[model samples]
Target: MTIRRILIANRGEIAVRIVRTCQRLGIVTVLAASEADLDSQAARLADQTICIGPPKSSASYLSVDAVVGAALAAKVDAIHPGYGFLSENQRLAQACSAVGIIFIGPTEAQLDAVGDKLKARSHALAAGLPVVPGGEVDSVEDARALAEKTGWPILIKAVSGGGGRGMKLVHEPDQLAATIELAMAEAHASFGDPRVYLERYVASGRHVEVQVLGDGENVIHLGTRDCSIQRRYQKLVEEAPAPNLRDGLRADMHCAAITFAKHLEYRGLGTVELLVDCERDTFYFLEMNARIQVEHPVTEAICGLDLVAEQIAVAEGKPLRLTQDDVHLTGHAIECRINAEDWTQDFRPSPGTVSRAVFPLGEGVRVDTHIQTGARVPPFYDSLLAKLIVHGTDRTQALERLRHALAQCVISGVSTNLPMHVELMQQEEFARGGVNTAYFPWFLENRATALRDQRVAKGN
Candidate 1:
């Protein structure tokens, strides 16, 4: 059966993304928004809109009752919890199923099993995938012992959280306890779950992830994306066909990801992120994001697939129309996240009315955005204003196109991370590829001139 209508249970660019696909497929869209997002493009463009609750996320976006109620009130057949917010919440998924509304993601059981990072590691290991060097530390003393055994410079991570929240990196044994406490506190405050895990932090590693689509019985990997360019653990730029991936490494990573997904009987869209140590020619399973990712457009750009449409199809119990062999990933694609933040001020949120906003339109450039000239950037949600995705036959061509697109793009009345993205693209090491995760932080310290050049370019 085809989906009649879908309720978008989140906000920002993803909401706009799903609405566009629904329109293309002739499926109606019901958008549920917080009070702050009542004026959002999703609310404006959707066939139906409902005010879930107040601007505060707890009373609105994160509130399972409000979201499910909105779905029931809209009389929609399914609910798409776009990335973030309640996307990975097992209770929310179960609630949707309880009301007979399709949850456009994996089953509650899968979510629960993978929600905890340590348990997910076991699952990956059981599926013959390589896991990281650390796991759940039973107590503070156990955490100390694990840190000593794993060596210093490890990461204290909140298993239940994403978006880089609830994480701390300790460079020495002396800092482990303090970092763990901070991580746990942040985790408890951010996700309402204080559970934390440990992992050996690779100083220089490539952040490679495989995108997979499943229909309970079968799983197919679209391709790999290199997301090494990040700040504060939040990815800023991503590209398909990860640059300089060794022969067979891509296939191995894809196979491992698919194995993990099929083992859990995963359904719908998900991404398994991994850390590839280029120097050692080895990779380790990091974590699995059990929902459509923000950078999914890059995957779609090269694979020539409509992931959102496939997601809806899978949610409706339709088989993935394409086979593993049919999923051919071609060309090179890059995506730059355009966020409403001031790069000069440590990427502080810059929320205000966009005085003048114009997107670059040209060959290979696809702008996924909900903001316009007069739209007000609300502080209640994520600062992501748009995603600028471009494709080309190769990495060089893709980079050239990205530079041109950024040149033509325009935004006003708010400082943005556009400057940082442009600079990172032009960085020599980034252009060469095969750099590790720590490259960004190192670049921030060593490349002051690049940042200056970016400011000058922005002015012109």
Candidate 2:
């Protein structure tokens, strides 16, 4: 079905991004905002906007019935669910199908198959893809034996967990049972599911993911993104064309991702996250995100493909205009997630009015944001305020561009993580691309002096 008008079941910059894409395609955009987001940037950008429900997500974005009702009321042909909130909800996908609205994403069966980490691992391994060495143990004794087999320092992760929640790292067998029970309880609270599984943790490994676009039959890999720079499993910065890979690693990674995607006959834009163990020179499938990622612009910068536009075309039953060989990646792109949080206070959410807002802008710089001067940062949702992206000829040039952009970014009236980002880009380890999952904790501990020195230099 052709998408004449799309109802966006999201808010913030993602919603605005979708609206801009639809507008470019000469399609009307219908934005559904909650009571708190009526005056938000997305609400202002949409061709038409409606207040769906109250401030809480349970009554607004997460309410499938309310969202479908809003879409029907606006007479939209499709619904674009930007990442987060209800993006991965299988019930929402089915509900959209039931209402005869183009969901603009993968099928409900696909969502359910991959929504749970354990199930996704089973499917991926069966499809001849290398998955993390772990799976569900039906009993506590079984988990202990598996831990013994997998060795110490295993991760007990929730099957339906996202955003780093419901995860616990246990280093010894003695602590396994308690951690398992704790992880299960956390999982139950977070996702309303109590199932937990174990995985052999990869220390000093990088988090790299391949971006794939598929329309049920044709699947193509759009290069890779390095999302290793994260804290508490939430990425703070991401870059396209991951810094380094051994001989033919990129091709191998791309092939594995495509194989996995095609095996499932997936649709739309999704990312296959993998944990790359540099020490062993091997990669393991981590998880799949069945939605447009927040770091998509970085890939677009290098590949020069508008993923959101492709999503719209695929929803309209159009075959992919470009093939795998057609995707030509050029230059390096980096993105820093600007959040309304104070890094010094353990990254606690800090919401307030934006007293001053000055974004970096020039050649090779792109800022996707929903905040403006004097705008009040709502405490009801994610603290993500903006995304500062930049492109350059290579990693060095990209770092140079990121340094300039970070220096130019300014946000006042709230304690933001701008200082940490600035410190991160200036550090020698980051500059040399020597990073992995353990990098953040190391940086937070040992880089304090370097950060202070950089701050002093900048002040001078």
Candidate 3:
């Protein structure tokens, strides 16, 4: 139960992040890597490595049996499914329990409670939290009926989906049935679940979330994060202590998150996502992610906590060490997800051997990456290459530091979104902050229009 050794059932930057924490905690790390990732940075940093399967995630990272079997073979005391892959998987948690190995996350029941979008909504409502108006639809007729009640421009969402996959927007009644079928097919293909639900789309909403840790009986929130800068509903930039909130709004969000976590008697680390409708000046519960998030470093930066260490300690059944009063948030922190993608080419994935990799280093700057010169950027996995994080005394300083940091970053031999990040940091609206979820798409459209105008001016 002390977790002397941990099997890291993930790869890339997150795997490396877990390894660093395990090392600092004096815990030996065993990496459950795919054949394609055996030579990865995490594999190199880990005390030992085992090939779980081939390059495909289905045969490797996503396979509960493969991950647990590798943990058994390695004799690790626990398994850390960092962030993605099987991080939110209830079966993996149950499998760890059956094997007498600790899963550094929420319980199987908690996963079941929050894994389905509709179930999560019910729980949130039960916790006295407001939720978007919507319900599950079994057929096209059901969807149409719900859409009629929810009004036009409803969002069709998969029950078992995240990261924007299996989500569709319907702007009118004519697109209902076909959109329903298309959404169902996509949901089934992406999440192995055809079940979909509808929600009234908040036209001017900001994506915000609060980080909470619990020991099943006691819970405390670590403040809020703004993740509104996104493309296709996938966050590209995140900041801690979500900027431009009205007075008491941050405290309200934190309290709501704690209320929901206590209602579930939740344990371990989780993020309670919410949609803040700027026009209405109100917030609604979105869902709870029962695992570490990619943007966790921003919270860690401001709170001065090693979230991974705290997570492991909680898994060891240790009670909460810090009280709400003891926890202090001192500064602003920002994180940019640097991915191996050609943003100019519609964010196409770029996979190749890295010829050069350079990141900024200074006070208040942190770069979490698994890439190095000569490293292979595999096409089979998530395009994420690194997370660039920076901290400052306030939002302005953080933005300034982030701009300089983005300027210093350089990744070659594969197309990366570094250029896009640089431009985003300089955008006037982004600099002002508190942009809505639609802002990023609008930025893209505006950029395209500017490019066209530039082409015409060149011809003239």
Candidate 4:
């Protein structure tokens, strides 16, 4: 089952990342690109490239038939779906199999196991892991009744969702009915599934996840990552070996993640996300991503492992290269998702041609990006332009290293969230590792209010 050649059914930094790994492994790569990405970094790096369709993602990246057709036409041994678009689409995996091509991520059954949040919660609970106070509801009344038991400040989420698309937070009983109705409508439009569920909302919780690898037999964890810094439910910053995690609690969380992955027979690279109530020193299963996550570089920095290469090896039917006993974690790594968005405009997408792109340079600094001078930032895709990662021997060192690197980064002609990252690094709470999922949005609002007060005081 050796993979001689593979087609990347994706585009972006992730696609380029896969190309580099394939090149290092001496495997030929065929990049499947939309018309807008024909001149992308991934296209240039691939040994061969094919135009799948127009720039519209629906006709190109999301088209299972188009991706499979390209793979079959090229006679590739496998197709790698990089992190987004069709990455977790079980239909894409099935299509690949139907065309006699290997899909390098999870199998259809495995995808089904954790694809839906509600079902994933059940799976985690069955694996001896705890879950939040939540359950699927049939109607608004059902959600209202569950919320009453879960207490006020309940979260209503779409059963089939990610990135907080169909999620609503209801703080009082009077808001339940309207919130549930709106959430259901949003869910139906977003995922074509109107089902909703209610869960207890944690007042202060840290978003933590474990990096895991499975070979259809056993699963091993790389370590934990703290992704507490977020905005609009999107991760803005991530750090490996979560800082300030309680000693025994950290061990328990790791054990739970490993158990959950093994119970599902997870294959390839996946992330088991959890929400930890830091005050209570307890955690609950959130969801599982059955593909390489965007924040994987932090795990790689600390463990000194190439996750993508391991994914390919596993797809070739090779056992995991390292066992759990071999895992030796050291140092602290932090990653900033440098997106092409204007912080002044609520992180609105800044899609345009880059006049200059200069990232940081030096030891312990890594820039995973595809944009360069004159590169067009397509409007049809995610705003993520690059990932700025830094590593050091400890959390303090890593924080300082990241701060220095963010200051040095200079990507002109496109408004980015770099200012926000720079500002966050200087905050006392963030420096003390006291950040949680709500910290970023709160910081932004407070910062704006302070600026307005300053202007008023100056009689502007």
Best by TM-score: 3
Q: After superposition, which runs of candidate 3 have C-alpha atoms over 4 Å from their true positions? A: none
Q: Which prediction has more favorable lDDT, 1 or 4?
A: 4
On a 0 to 1 TM-score scale, where does candidate 4 land against the true structure?
0.98
lDDT for each of the candidates? Answer: 0.89, 0.90, 0.94, 0.91
Candidate 1 residue-wise lDDT, 238-345, digit = tens: 999888987688889989999999999999899999999776788999889899999999999999999999998998898889899898778899999999999877
Colliding pairs, model 4: none
**On residues 11-33, what C-alpha lDDT tens digit does candidate 4 reach at each position?**
88999999999999999999999
User: In candidate 2, which residue ranges exceed 4 Å CA deviation?
Assistant: 448-460
The digit string of per-residue lDDT tens for model 2 on 1-460 reads 7789899999988998998888888999989999999988898889889888999988998899889999999999999999998898999899888988999888999999899998899889987988777779777898998888887788888999998888989998888888888889999988999998889888878999999999899999999999999898999999989887874887889999999999999888999999998888989999999999999999999999899999888878888888988999999999999999999878999988999999988889999999888888889999999999999999899889899999999999988999999988888888888489899888897766777899999999
What stretches of model 1 exceed 4 Å from their correct place?
449-460
Number of backbone-clashing residue pairs for each candidate, in the order shown: 2, 0, 0, 0
RMSD each, Å: 2.9, 2.8, 0.7, 1.0
Every model's TM-score:
0.96, 0.96, 0.99, 0.98
Q: Model 4, 81: alpha-carbon shift in Å?
A: 0.5
Instruction: Put the candidates in lDDT order, highest first.
Output: 3, 4, 2, 1
User: Number of clashing pairs, model 3?
Assistant: 0
